[model samples]
Target chain A: MTDPRLAYVQRKTRRRLAFSAVHLVLYFSFSLNWSSWGEPLSHRLGVTQVTGSLLMFILLVLIFIGMEFLFLQMESKETQE
Target chain B: MKAMFLFLLRSAPLLVLSGVAAAAGSIDGEVEQQPLNTTAIVMFLLFVVMTLLITWRAAKTTTSSAAFYNAGGKITGLQNGAAIAGDFMSAASFLGITGLIFVGGFDGMILSLGAFAAWPLLMFMFAKRVRNLGSFTFVDVVSQRLARGQIRIVASIGTIAVVIMYLIAQMVGAGKLIQLLFGLPYEVAVITVSALVLAYVAFGGMLATTWVQIIKATLLLTGVTLIAILILARTGFSFNELLSLAVEKHPKGEAILSPGVVFKDPVQIATIQVSMLFGTLGLPHILMRLFTVPDMRQAQLSAFYASLFMGYFYLVLLVLGFGTVAFIYGNPEYFDADGKLTGGINMAAIHIASAMGGDILTGFMSAVSFATILAVVAGLTVSGAAAISHDLYAQVIKQGEPDPKTELRITRIAVFVIGLVAVVLGIAFENENVAFIAVMPMVTAASVTFPILLLSMFWSGLTTRGATYGAIAGFLSSLLLIVLGPQVWVSVIGNEQPLFPYDYPGLFTMPFAFAVIWLVSVTDRSARGEIDRANYHSLLVRSEFGEKAAGEGAVG
Candidate 1:
């Protein structure tokens, strides 16, 4: 009654967890640097407090997109393997 | 894993600082004063028309029960994702959170952030399971390994509880928003929203609701983004300056950033967070969206997209809330004759928009708000209807095959019935505290349905007896607790003091439900090896990657 499918699923699960772990590290490191970069841009952009907040928002979104892209790439490699 | 920990660690400090900032606000100064404008009227009409058009278009294609209940299973991952975003981004997110943040500061954003954070967990936990189940109701997913009759009874309770709670919250919010923005009578607003949502669901079914949600989500995101940009433009792009402005206007300047300054009660903050985060993952209406997508991968992808969309929208709300705080404090016009913030806290979004964007933008924003209400109600109605027509009536009662025609008729009728029930409930409970009521039902649903659903998918030992008993136990305990819980007793029943410290039952009830299911399953020897291995495999793996696999099978 050994199910090959179960083993396959277990392997997939492990790989996904590994991928997720890598993603978490990248996002955390990137987010820390974001505020420092955003502060200088806020001054240079001469936007109001709210506008500066909005720009920060835009930056966060960009970073999220990059992370998602990285995730997709990782997923693709796993699928190929 | 490391990345997630890092993300959490980085966010921890900001969250703490923000908590401190929120506590300094006095309830009196936190309210806004603003005049209602003509723009709100135009926006209302626009949403009404948009809803009608979408419903009419949906009616043409929704010729069968499947179409009505599950959009005939035709919706793409992207479309469904947008719709999911639309459904989740209710008037509460657009208006309530913004207003709460505007008044309460960082504490409000914490609620928003916590709710948004639940999306990824949902993706990981439920997305594949639900999509694989391929059933129209949460009952279908939970009942796959259990007896049909038992699943129906337990699931119906969970479904009704969540829908009723959610409907009441939306109706209350709609009534207040209508009165504030359009001078409509509260009763009239409630009836109008109920009727519009009913019509949208009845005629178009899931197709109409899905499109409406997609459109609404797009508009809401766009509107918030635009408003955020406008606010930033006014502030000269300085996050610190915006904080300074907010600080200067307050008596307890800079203290607004500190936690406990606004809410003062740590328990209340914790309660709000738990209810928002767990309640989100458990919501039947939200989880039902997974079934509408084409496959498991799409289901997962849609969730990811929804998280991104919701995360972005919440960030804008944070800015909008702070913008309102900074702008509205000095304005005498925002106050009523008694000098109380003229409208309830929820009106801050409209008031801020009116002030910043003038009449046209205000009108546009109001329309979007109206659309938000409409979109959310439509999603709720469709889910409710599916529970009745697809789960209870067709599957459990008739045991009929879900032929295209039967499903369509049943769905439309169910939509009408569910809509009627909501309207009646809304009318009767018009005076109740809508937010509190809404959160309670979601907790009940989450406590009951969430465990049953997860166990049915992953736990092979789960038997019909176990699932049935567990779901019932979870459903009753959560409902009873909520009804007798201090929040309900004091707030709804007008008791002087609450019996329980925590408002949410999830911290207790959710775990209890899972424990009951496990215990019951383990005790029943007959339950072992009950899982239909072939069926489960087909349901989960084949449905996800079967197209290519099917081709190979044919060659063999």
Candidate 2:
């Protein structure tokens, strides 16, 4: 006797968990590849390691800001619906 | 191979004697050698003036219990985000970790990176739930469906234990810094730092503390970035050259860039890494910052920013650590006449700075380090004050309408009490490896708090009895294991045998807590009906959208 409501909640939880898992794997893979490949590119680009790190940091910050805006816009759309 | 064996045999006696001397009188002599310079004196005065000014400003907004405890719930996410960075970037981040990497090499950097990796998990999992709950203590999130009284008691105990442990660590660090830079006696230094931190938080409240943290973080980042650039210039911006120089100096240098060379035991390394990563999310001081953000979105953003900043800072520390080994470690001038590395890791950063530029640069860096200690101690005091005054006093015992004015006074008193206790503990543990010992208490807090917090937010069936039992089980098990573990026994009784060979017990304790909560919740049918339909709906809505949608739905 599975409660339909509990089943629905479980389904949603599983989806969210799957999304998070994917995101985490992507992040880990990208960081590893970048650390290995990015170092030489940084040198070739005439950027010191510190300068290269700062650039990456700025990029990360912008990505987060963009995500926040996107999330907020989606919330607004949901409210209208 | 034969030469290496002879070298080890020759050095063993000196190492043994030094260890014995460190336990006896080494710290006291080190304290006497360095006195406070004019720059350090001026910086201390400046900190005092700034603290007073901020406290005065915070006094205007702190008119109620809510404002005093949580900045009136009006702080924007960006502001709160910066404060979160401030709080997380303690003396441990600035001085301790940097020193660790300088002395211990790769083992230290791994610890930092492992701790930093936990931030994303915290953001994705805990932050939104914490923000939606809008409670002062972490227990507030876990106890949403539980009896208020039960949650209050359990939460207060966990909060108190964690705050005390953290405060003691900060106090010890402050004492050590004072001894190194100011030549003050350890007892005097501990008292001075404790009193100053208490004053800042007692008067400033959350608003003042936030501003202080922001200022501290700004100064720290600026100082370190400058030092990193300077070091790069000195090395002609050649990363390979620096590495080669380090390798040439010590054949073991390459091992530093790689892992597992220092610890050797595979099991110990795995256990330690797991503990450092997961235990990070459960830290009480870190958790308290989530309550400061305006909404869930801000919470997530703030965590992302913190991780980025922390990662950048750690990379700089890698430079500083290797820079010290290359430039200052064996220099005759860096050591005292006895051939001892007289100043230890605290001097590692400034020595390199001096070598790069001159005495002027060293003075400036020292001032920055001094500011780092003050700022970190202030943040620790405020978080501890919140647990004592808000969680224990207003929510738990009083249960009366929280009068802001009276609560502020109580918070001040609480700060004083916490500061006094820290000073005493700092003095007692002056000779021990304070940073390593400090991590144990945080581990205990994380083990207890993390499982209960996670289950409560995600598991709708988490019952009151289950949470209470789970928290108690996690707290007691972790605490007992740590006390009986090698670190403590080695500190107290000179014993080498570890009860649980693992330095961190989270891998064992966290799952145990989750199991207890599940088992108890399953058995307790009475708690099945405790969930509020409206509140649960609001939580789900708030997590997905933001607070505005939840508010609109409530009105509709």
Candidate 3:
């Protein structure tokens, strides 16, 4: 079995990496002003503006939730160990 | 003089509340002439009644400092998430950031995005460590490996400073909101908010604060989502069309879609973003909420949930802010005779509500705004109370010998005192455009509290003297720079020249804070410094592995 302390560190490191990746995406989007792309993206995707923003929002939420669940799963494993 | 002062202080709340009632009554004729938002008033009162019931329940559960400060660590992750969101997304956010977007467009989005960026960092860096180490206050975490009494004294000073600054900002926002939505006098609004906040916090403590926050967050999220849907429906659900309509309706035309309206320089922009990022990480009330959860996992989950909710809420703000231009831009009902936006631009969200769903929806949004202000103020008061009663009175003053009864009593008295001070300052700054006041506390938190906590947690070389002096240095420098900065210097002090060129001091002072702690710790050769350095290994182990070590129960 993996050392629980080492496993905890690995899990934490993975979360940090995931967070950094998301932060990078956000930073570049805001810096390059690509956040305003939802309007055009919606038009190209043949969706309403509301749907476009909502879809984007739902996508971001899913990503965050996925990352969180992974972290929690690792935490549970550590506790079980 | 002292006796008279004591008597006046004791009767102040009653005096203020009665004065508010009389002032509210005197404006009856004018208020009657204007169309009444009776539905809004009724809904607001209903909310107040419901929250009071919650507080009454919470008061019975609050018996010890653990219960008073942390709600016995029984709050679920989701509930704590909502409460944290409530504490964060205050009236300033609902009104101020939306107003920023309505006026400055992309720049407002940038300001808001900066605020939201702090959450991911909170989850990554501080949330778990803070939850694992602290019970009641963030000071508990900082003092865990240091000298408890002295370190807490310094931490309390930082806590109360941030609290008072944040309180004044919330109070001003509440006062202005009531005046706009209910046509009440500003002083009366300030007093009314203070009274309700005091009742909840002084009686129910953290449990009530958490519930109030959770309820307000739910209401605010629901209300904003409804308005966003209405606005999108108006625009045929097209983001492009919404932007086009907003540009056409707004006086700035296509300039609204471009950045650099409010914040011009890139350095200034970066400074504000840094302030927002670390500032939220260090806010006393927000940090205090992390302790309300059961354990590190709950704390982590709470951060995740809060970030998700806030991310969605902020995106909704983007819609609400830009949608105002499409819907309410030229509406005479939302404008003054001079063609200015009524209640300044901050009423954009409310105007959008009125335009979309008429009086009932506007009333609901108005009531949510009131609840938002009240909930945030209650959160602030509880944290400020813990700083005073837990950190100052019990730990520092009484050397941790105070009984539970005395501690609880001190906490209640601190709540009253903090509420009264907030009211007085809120009323005094009524005409001062205190909207920007919210940013100051965040900057101060980033500068002072963030450095001290981060250093104490991670650095083995950091001593008690270093933490205390570093905190003082960071605290004083941030406040001093803000005073010398353009906002206070030219605007508040009516000066021709600002000593500090920047509006925000975070970029400079945050680094300086870290440097001061480094310099102080590295140079110190004292026996206490040696002991504190030696204790750092255990602190690191506990913070990293969730193991209890020495000083875990030092404060409690």
Candidate 4:
């Protein structure tokens, strides 16, 4: 029989991988076709041209940082259980 | 292709730094040797003295193999995370990328994001399992559930191969910087850097190395923060205004705001992104830092902190890059007689530093650059030494249990050998095509190290024979593709056409490696293969629960 801890940790690992996969997909979509991706976003947002491209890049990086925190938070939840 | 290929970095500066080695006197055009900046000398000397004193203290407790390899796993996640950032952010890379943005504008932000993609990848895939399973080097983790001796032999070959190339490029780059900064002769600079690296790893080990990294990271972060803040203040704290002013001054004008103005190619992007992604997974210095943490959670925290710091750092570079353009681009005082920026484009961040706070801040940044070289090279040397001592010697030659004192002695000896090798190679290859040397470490990491590491942890069917064959295949194929590819074949060998068309082979080679390992493993019906498959259960339990998992599994 599988240990409950193994089951719990595996679920956590799956979630981490799933989240990271989503992040990679976001990154790769832009990276692979950045010309098109940046074209629409390159339009000026408000007072500046800090448009879709820069905003999207910033969001991706934040998600990069946020994914780890999200994982750690999930980890804390497990310990409580 | 060259522009895209430049994005593959364990540390971003090493790639541009290779060119800086050659760009010293010839390309910068009539730029005379920089005078010995007294402030820089004083700052560097103070840093060296403090680090050496730390090394002396570290030497006292570095009596066992664990202390030597990983500081007895005593580093907290926050501290280890800062060290990882220091190791990742070479002063050269930080300045180099910022300078890139200073010249090219928005594209540099893309490259920063590209380099940063590694952090999430590492946190999800490598950090947790590697910390739980790996003891000293990556080889320890890779060899855990397999045939230990044979698997280590394979993994160690990859580690040592990658380390040697990475170490040599760093040594050569450090030498060039020292010569440029201190106005010293080239050979003297190489030897001096080598001597310091020997003192750090051979004597003080990881404790001294970690502290040096932490200190350097703190100084670099502070310098970048101060410079970013000072530059933003000039534009009334409005990032949009800064970009607008940059558009006005830049030669390319509004085109600088577009993505493809400098470079945009889909395949090239995929290739660099692939290498940076997988290469981070397989980089020995980073993988080595994983074991320095006490547990898996701390390991996760370390990667997270590194990501947070790097994210903040990259955002600053984006602003500072545009800010430098707005302020310094057309400013005649900062440019040379030919109307080029003095000391080429890589000096963009330095010029901004001078503008921000005059010679004092510039000198501090310069000293931090030199300190960065030391910390990076020291980490590489330790990883290389551990590959020789812990993986090859103890795990392979001594059958996995060498005497502690004996292993420690072997590690120090290996350190000396690598130091000597780096010194000789640094001086010998000073004028050679450094780009060729720069990409080799990534080829091995992306193809061999990352593939095997991923498969070993995730696959249940892997056998020793399959792993060995798979690793050797991946390493050779990647190396061959690189030699036949654009960077080496066309750029270095003067060929009209590259046999392999891409700048990097990882986009093809990584998938090929996974296929080879899978194909070989599934076909292996040997009894040992069965045992290898069965061992994955306990390996999984141990990896998930760490050392607290007793015997076969954890009993919560």
Best by TM-score: 4
Which regions in candidate 4 have their CA more than 4 angstroms from the true location?
A: A1-6, B1-33, B548-556
Task: Report how far residue B88 has shifted in candidate 1, in Å.
Answer: 1.0
- Deviation from truth (RMSD, Å), model 1: 8.0
Tell me how each candidate scores on DockQ against the true complex.
0.13, 0.11, 0.19, 0.65
Candidate 1, residues B185-297, lDDT tens digits: the string is 76887788878888788888888889888988888888888888888888797666777787676444544443333445544554455555566777778888887877666
Cα lDDT tens digits for candidate 2, B301-359: 67766766666766777777667766765577776665445565446566787787676
lDDT of each model, Cα atoms only? 0.64, 0.60, 0.74, 0.76
lDDT of 4 by residue, B487-553 (tens): 6798679999999887667788888888888898999898777777887777777777776334221
Which stretches of model 2 miss by more than 4 angstroms?
A1-16, A19-81, B1-33, B431-436, B527-556
Per-residue C-alpha lDDT of model 1 across residues A1-81, encoded as one tens digit per residue: 377766666665555556545533433332221234423432324433333333444454455555554655655576688
Q: In lDDT terms, how accurate is model 1?
A: 0.64
Off by over 4 Å in 3: A1-81, B1-36, B433-436, B551-556
By lDDT rank, best first, the candidates go 4, 3, 1, 2
Better of 2 and 4 by TM-score: 4
Lowest lDDT block of 10, candidate 2 chain B: B20-29
- CA RMSD of each candidate after superposition: 8.0, 6.6, 8.9, 4.4
**DockQ winner:** 4
